[model samples]
Target: MEPLYQYAWLIPVFPLAGAMLVGLGLISFNRATNRLRQLLAVFIVSWLGASMVFSFAILWSQFHGHEPYQRTLEWAAAGNFHLMMGYTIDHLTALMLVVVTTVAFLVMIYTDGYMAHDPGYVRFYAYLSLFSSSMLGLVVSANLLQVYIFWELVGMCSYLLIGFWYDRKAAADACQKAFVTNRVGDFGLLLGMLGLYWATGTFDFDVMGANLETFVESGYLGAGMAAVFAVLVFLGPVAKSAQFPLHVWLPDAMEGPTPISALIHAATMVAAGVFLIARMYPVFEGIPVAMTVIAWTGAFTAFLGATIAITQNDIKKGLAYSTMSQLGYMVMAMGIGAYGAGLFHLMTHAYFKAMLFLCSGSVIHGMEAVVGHDPILAQDMRLMGGLRKFMPITSLTFLIGTLAICGIPPFAGFWSKDEILGSTFEVSPILWGIGWLTAGMTAFYMFRMYFSTFEGEFRGNEME
Candidate 1:
């Protein structure tokens, strides 16, 4: 009997259908009824839940057989060239599918209680479903072109979700900033893809992976030319993963809903870069100079994020910078040829980061209930303290997340980060030192944010 992996394409389809159903409410479906809204939520949850289950099945097959399952279909044809669309079910895709769907499902479940009173409740869930589909599509994509297509779709959904509260100017501006910033990376990606196609006449990842050396040598390309193409491709990951100058958009992204922040921080948007680099590891492995650039870029970005995070008074923005720092760790691992370590960190970070962001949302929700949701005090850590007494469960979960990110022993971050640091030690002690120093700073800032938010006296206006 054939394995169930061949049906991997359906993973994204279910969420897409859920998004479509929720969207129909805008026209004639009369979604305002509480009973209908509850049913829609149930339907969306079932689809995402199914996707996660299917992902786990593929993972089981992968470990048992060590064989990737693939299914391809012709998307378009021109002359002798063919554009294909399909699914690739490998260990990486299987892991990513589970991570994306799992985070999305949890966030959706949490949103019901968190966003219950919002006027745009139905629209919120619709966008969440759309975001889930976009991310899963990217995960199962069989080719670079398909990845690019879904990459842009993920960006679009992020833009819509970030500016979800359109009446607020800050939300609107943050959305514009994020969209425009990503375009910088996308432009380079487009150029690199066009060059690759011009040189090789095919956009399929498997084909390109197998024939890259032959294709590059066919043009008799020099080191400089090869480096240029590699760097251009690297730009896409840098921007999406929030490395260095391209990383400024992520902190401002806190203007979005906290659940959306968790999605972006954990599995969907930012993880895209690290995942793509892992998928195309062969290309980078061939270029030594490109690898060096990636290592130093990650080092500097990690330190920069740690420093900024230490100074941030806004709880969500502090966590945002921490995510940037963690992503840098993943990128540095990839640069040093520790592909497994990079992916390991990505997986562990997904769990803890999602927990951290959700806990922050819970904190904000409780505070809003107490203070009546004032715009002036929203998400400001300066106005939040002694929350642990009021929200012990949220505080405990958030504390666990802080410990995990700090690389404390017996925690997920400790395991993954140790691998990255150990991998760096073999390559360059200087880089290892940088990674170590950043780890210390990560612990400091994470605790600083936690204490400032949950300890001491109430920081909010006492009269309120």
Candidate 2:
């Protein structure tokens, strides 16, 4: 039997193919029957299911001592300058593959039930498939150029999906906000990539790692120039991960559908930023000043997000800020040089945060059924009360997510979060103090949202 890594190319292909087919169906069959729609949903989901299985199998192979895999085909060349299309799968890519494919597969399944009555059913599926494919491509990219190509594609997919409900003015504006804000970061990313190439003469990460120190020692790459390059690259993650000033766009992104919120805020887009910093660890490690900047940025963002979440009344916006806070924790972990702990939190956060958003989606869905089409009234936690009787499973699952995010014992989040806190304490007790306070606030606001929505009497006005 062939090792699963050899078939890794199929992982991204399956989703891209599903997207093309569904997109063609949308154009060809405008008035698709219920049966036809169901079939399309099943077909696209099965494709992702296949990708998920393969992703897991590949991850399994990696754990069992499989070597990293790479396949490169030259795309362009001018003298010594060459561009290649390829993928590299090692520990990081393998982990991301499983995370992206698994969460995407589950989200699509949930969306089938959630969007059953919506007019954009087929289009939504197509966008999701495209989104998954772009992220998959990004994780497996072999070089900075490949990563950048897929990076922009991922951003474009986000823009499309965040505005999926284009008729809603809020959704339209939110997508634009996301797009423009990210462009600022992307320009920084492009400049950084060019600087790296100028210093090292290649975009391949492994090559850059091997040659960076030699270049710096030989006067080809100055220490100051290297630090500048690293910081410019850092801006990409600062914005993409919703760090500080760039974070304004994410809360507004709640205007989009909830699944997109879960995908972007939880696992894919925001996660990409931290993942980039992790991938480029060697360069940043050399610059103590750059590392300090990252650590403080993450520390401040964590405190800010938790404090803001405490003030939110809109359920989704509350969760959005919570995501921002949680992401800050992960980035702080990266900044503190707790690489393993940072990634541990990323994986744990992916599962629980995605669950929290989905649980919130279930609540909003139920509210719409009872309260009619009042988006504002439906999302207001002030109006939501005594919902557990109507949604036992969602409430229970949501509580589990609440406890997990709050870092309670025996939960996945506790172990990961504890690791980060321990690492933070060793680095700076001041930052650790902030992290500890943020943890307390996290518990308070999460339970506050929970009690407001799931306890006491139902306060919502019912539809006639």
| lDDT of candidates 1 onward, in order | 0.87, 0.89
Which numbered prediction scores highest in TM-score against the true structure?
A: 2
Worst 10 residues of 1 by lDDT: 26-35
Clashing pairs in 1: none
Compute each candidate's TM-score over C-alphas.
Answer: 0.96, 0.97
Cα RMSD, each candidate: 1.7, 1.7
Q: Where in model 1 is the C-alpha error above 4 Å? A: 1-3, 30-35, 215-219, 462-464
Candidate 2 local lDDT, 1-464, one digit each (tens): 25566668888899999999888867777776334888888989999899999988888888988888898999999998889888888899889999999888888998988888888887888899999999898898889888889889989999999899899998899999999999998899899989988888888887876677788788877878887887888888888899988898899889888888888887789888988888888777767778888888898999999999999999999999999999899888988899999899999999999999999999999888777777787898988899999999999999999999999999999999999999999999999999999999999999999999999899886323
lDDT of 2 at 58: 84
